[model samples]
Target: MNLRRLTYLGIAVCIASVPVLAVPAQPRSVEYRSPVDLVLLKNDTWLVVANQTSNSVSLLETKSGKILDEILCGDHPSAIVACLDGQHILVSCAHSGQISLIQVEGGKLNEIHTIDVGFEPTGLTVAPNGKTAYVGLVATGEVAELDLVQAKVARKFSVGAWPRYLTVSPNGERLAVGCSGESKIVIVDLIQGEIAYSSKLSGGINIGHLQCSADGKYVYFPWMIYRSNPINRDNIRRGWVLGSRIGRVRLDKQEYREAITLDVPGMAVADPHGIVMDSSNKRLVVSAAGSHDLLVYRRDDLPWEGVGGPGDLIDPKLMQDRDLFQRIDLGGRPMGIAMARDGRTVYVANYLKDAIQVVNIEDRSILRDIPLGQRPRPSQVRHGEELFYDARRSLDQWYSCHTCHYNGGVNSKAMDTWNDGSALTMKTVLPLEHLDRTGPWTWHGWQEDLHDAMHKSFTTTMQGRPASPREADAILAYLKTDRSPPNPFREKDGSLNESAIRGQKVFAGTEANCISCHNGPHFTDGEIHDVGLGSEEDEYQGYNTPSLTGIYRKVRFLHDGRAGSLEEVLSDYHSPEEVSGTRAMTESELADLISYLKSL
Candidate 1:
């Protein structure tokens, strides 16, 4: 089936499955206090959940519901996977690009070894035989394997774009890696160390987390398609920041097939956050970050029916009264998931909830909820060296200017919603890499100097202290290395979309006249234009065209986010109402121009 049809079918099943019940929300207990990742161990008696934000792990007594111990790790600890014996833990610290080994014996944890990896090791898994542990480097397209026996590096292999989470098959012959950048899956033959197979999905970008069915017949990974349409320079800016879907691939085959994929049913595909498999009873659990709900799919039937038959999956007849087995409400935003050995329970890590959610698998019931930390964002590792401990910012509480503008690209989609939102308008967050080279801050090009803009924006908008002369210098030091997130959407063979190719012709041609300013890798000529489009609030009629690197992550266009879509902007030049004084263009030309802008 086509991706659109598959998406609808999955949503239809979910919608049909709902049965009304007067179920009361469960009470909150066993606050995580900083829970990151969880693993079942010691014959299912103990559960170790990574408290990465707080640099520790919470040991839990599963049967007794008791907190056993809180073992500390150094710096930013992220993912955690257990050894085959379940007596040790491997965690990655992306901040320092290091992986840490923590030995667990007799209910206590001890530091073992620290091995340095590449940029941002976010996902990890131990081989079935407990001989090798694979680590996914988020920023680098590579996987690093650590030898379990010696607790040292075994080997590393290059893979597809921005590998996030990885999984090993039960027999230990095959390994699957998920790439967020290219929206593809690469399966490697462990013995031969060669990529045995690969599956590419359309609308598949930013793919996260891979899960293998208990029988090892099916492999599942969450696929997200960023909305891509290039109609105008403005719409190209909006890009595909928001996405949707839960996708599965057949592993036995050498080629990838789109099987049993589900859309973000009741909600806009904000982010398909997490995936976990309950091996005991054949349950597939997915956490939808947009809806903040845990979705359950049962494998008793073919194509893994949802709650109801086909259309009933959304509101499954079998799950109407099964609160514990269907959907569970996480108090806040849910991001990650892990299952217990027996499949009787599943653990959820909430990014915004600041806690870990424990759910009973059989009845779809939430058995316990534990509070873990503040602002947990899918951590997977712990490093041995204290590299980040003495950094400028303290461990407990210090948010960097870069925190908001990740990798200098403003990776997030949040708007400046402060009361004085006008001053901190869309133009305020202009890219800094090309500054000095690119004049002014904000769309209006109001502040000419870099120092003034930083001081005013940080103090007024961020509610941050106005940096002292020395402090401002330090902040500027951090801002100077501003580089945009790399573009993975460009075709693999280096071919541009046909429409985008046409659009490119029109862009530089006189018909569009867009190339007068927007050009280069940054996609901006660092020049301002009147274009005859501005509001009364546009104190300055002209604005600097911002860089296009990762423009898909941006939400607004122009100085005030006035343009809603790229198509609107391209078509606006023709609309007397919106375009006002700009030159008019035909609809076909507009579409072609939009296709071109998107190629960028």
Candidate 2:
């Protein structure tokens, strides 16, 4: 369902099926164009895609890339999944905070039910039994467990902040939720309904799409590697600096060993997003969203070569038999990659272009340039969006704005932007939303206005030529529309729950004494505070009081990426400015406090 909807018409590719890894007679590439997630329906009969920008769901014939129907849905659809029954498609809309159950009867799609799950539903997965669906509630830091048969939310349980994606074990005994906000994955014991384990990955590890090995021994995900506390663009200029790594964590233990990596001395991959492995586990496919390419790897062909620096995710072997079989050009912003059940083709969702690029996996060529729908006309917002994802503007076409922001959101990594006119004092990348009011920009609060920051970001951070004032205006225009998503914990009537209501008292109360600095429409005063958090090595002691409006989406917090969770921010590293007795608060009280903070 994460794949997007189509327009009235679609572009068809070849209908011929190719066995796994077959080389097609023809070699070509094309894109239809658009957003969010891509999911191949059961039996390879239909391709269901979620379009966040278009507010619709697209269904297409498995073969020939033919459009079946496009169903209108709620706002900002995030994730989609085909039910175990093979007759239902679940679509999660972030802004609408609801799940639409599209019933597939007689090969036609129908919107059968719309159930309110929670706010900012970004990720989804279904239980093997086909009776349950787990949705990641981004705004509330919880997972709403829905009974598929009942078609209602059964319950909700707390997870890490901004849980973005879900992957279930083959045996159905364990579940891995990609905790994007925490830069880790929380494994839940399904039977026990408790956290079984957590893989605390390194910084900038935005586990975009997670897939369990066939044996379920490891969880494979695409990760960003920028190990130094503050990233060094010098390394990036050399090409080996930042790595888009494909990593595997042993489900049984904690380790950061690399099975594959997408960076080397030159021609680094930009943004690696959608990831999928064939049912045979023989092939691995990754969608490099920023670079607009699909890189396929043969598991048996993994090169023994090892790479070092900024933490090598390289295969440790010295031999250079690259496991990668082919790197096909997708020619658009590819978001999600979904493999068909027949193992012949992979469907790609190009987030910005409003089309799906179907690739013949065996031939290693794009067979069709299918358009689900036509994107809107020219506008400042759309132009800015194009500019944001345009890697051509970067030095040697290495990256784009989307490479760092990952669709206007944080990559959860500290950056050595060199904007401070200092070295090694890297600042974490800030969210682009509500920037008009969240200034002064940057962790150091150096730029009072965004206009000044744009020049610095281009010349200093990107290591490229300065952007024109007109170009900067267009980028800001698109960014201005990036407001905070709805809070999932709030009721339909816009009232907080009893626990959150009580927790609000702790937040604003004299006991906590937090309002003087955190007050205002966005829950921030737009000023700096020392908060007793300064280290001798730090350049400046005081840090900006950032808006809490979208705190739930943060992977790390504080001046640097120190606190991984709100609990850690409040209790383990409670600052002098925080509430009294926070460290000694009861578990129930902590939950209430967190609930209230997440609501904001």
Candidate 3:
């Protein structure tokens, strides 16, 4: 069979064929201004947006709402931050693993420097003195501190797993890093250059942008809490299964954290991304990316601690108070927010609409929608991408498909979505990179029909209205476009290293015997086997052989996430002696084998 290579976010993978409706591809010249993050630069006169898909940055005049200029940068620019000097801004190019520093010179953006940081640089922040900057390296699980003057990485310190965002305290003494994979907030003492506190968020996932208080007392962010209960209507309605929250971590102390539930009886917030506070600190705004709205809250009036007593996450009386909180609906997905100095006007990076919405908090209305630039016409794949991220598709607008499979990738947690025949059977979220080629969906290899599986996800797992046939086809089209990121373990020319090359021999040899069930280009035979890893609660006795293509991206392994590392998966649970009835590999052999697996 012939194969075609697909590349997204710098990662390339081979697929046998397109499985869904073939949408027309856009021209390479047409810019898709998927504005993910933005910041107010040049003293609020200019709004700078990080156009993710376009691989550029757009500088817009705040007053006239005109696109001043679009400057090309590194690939997949994810976040932008204005420097304290008011003349330069930094953009974190995620796919390129580089930070582009641009100077704001007389209404024009000039690329000054490109600092090669590390893999997946997502969040960025500058210190009070503007001398140093911090970047959250997602894949490396470390925070890289850059010396602004030197234009190079000064040092790196490990925070936690997948640090997606970072915030610096007002005093510039502490930097709070949000580690989404581990669901922990690591506070780095800038003065001492070490981790001061590591506050774990129980059941937290998808931790969003972080904003430190003016007084340097707390760091606030938006995140989702997963309750591993059966996917039933009662649990979903009561916000017991999956819910949203705005969490805070005390910077002055260790392991001190608190959160307020953003969900009410009927209405709930989902995929809360960007968060900001005004200069006066009276208003707090959070962009609900999944729900496509801006949640504005009165900062002082929020019931944080004394509302319903100890261990109370939500207060009914406070939730019913409309004056305390207001939701302003914006049609497109909102990822980042920039508050004006006036404290009422807010700018939102609307991803789907390819525009920035200027919202008025006092009147609770969208004042204007500033178009970033011209984009391609909407296709079935585009609509499918919208549906995949829209939380309104779920019951009570609680979660979207992206809530679990983040950006068509996997979340670090195993969830009991109840898609299988049994309940309470937690399974790791499988990545949708090559979903079209990987037939027989689900862990048990039970979902033979892809369209039926999509319908069941909406109807059963999400407990929402079943998708129409057309909608399902659109989703499938979007999934076909999804691809895994470039494996960092691979060489620059995409060749295996010496260790991996040696390990590849062992994999094909009988000692490891890994190629027996996993013997395809995608590394899966598409067959189910009794791996002896199933629990008694599992309805299905055998498990499907999963593809090991992007196994390096996964922090948790196995069907139920029991194996924390690839070494654990090979040495402890599914060892050669246990599965293939062979002798255990030596430590050197195991190390080489892991290196080879990561290269895939």
Top TM-score model:
3
Candidate 2 residue 353 Cα shift, in angstroms, is: 2.0
Q: How many residue pairs clash in each candidate?
A: 50, 24, 0
Model 3 lDDT tens row, 381-451: 98999999988999988899999999998998999988887899999999898898887789999889999
TM-score of 3: 0.93
TM-score per model over all chains: 0.58, 0.83, 0.93
Residue range 395-480, candidate 2, lDDT tens digits: 65557886667668776776666777667776667778887877777666767978888887887667777879889999999899
lDDT string, candidate 1, 91-172, tens digits? 7766556677767777655556677664567789888888689998765478888887776778888886567788888878
TM-score of 2: 0.83
RMSD of 1: 17.0
Worst 10 contiguous positions by lDDT, candidate 1: 1-10
TM-score ranking from best to worst?
3, 2, 1
Model 1, position 244: C-alpha lDDT score: 44
Who is ahead in lDDT, 1 or 3?
3
What range of 10 consecutive residues in model 2 has the weakest lDDT sum?
A: 22-31
Q: Provide the lDDT at 102 for model 2.
A: 83
Name the better of 2 and 3 by TM-score. Answer: 3
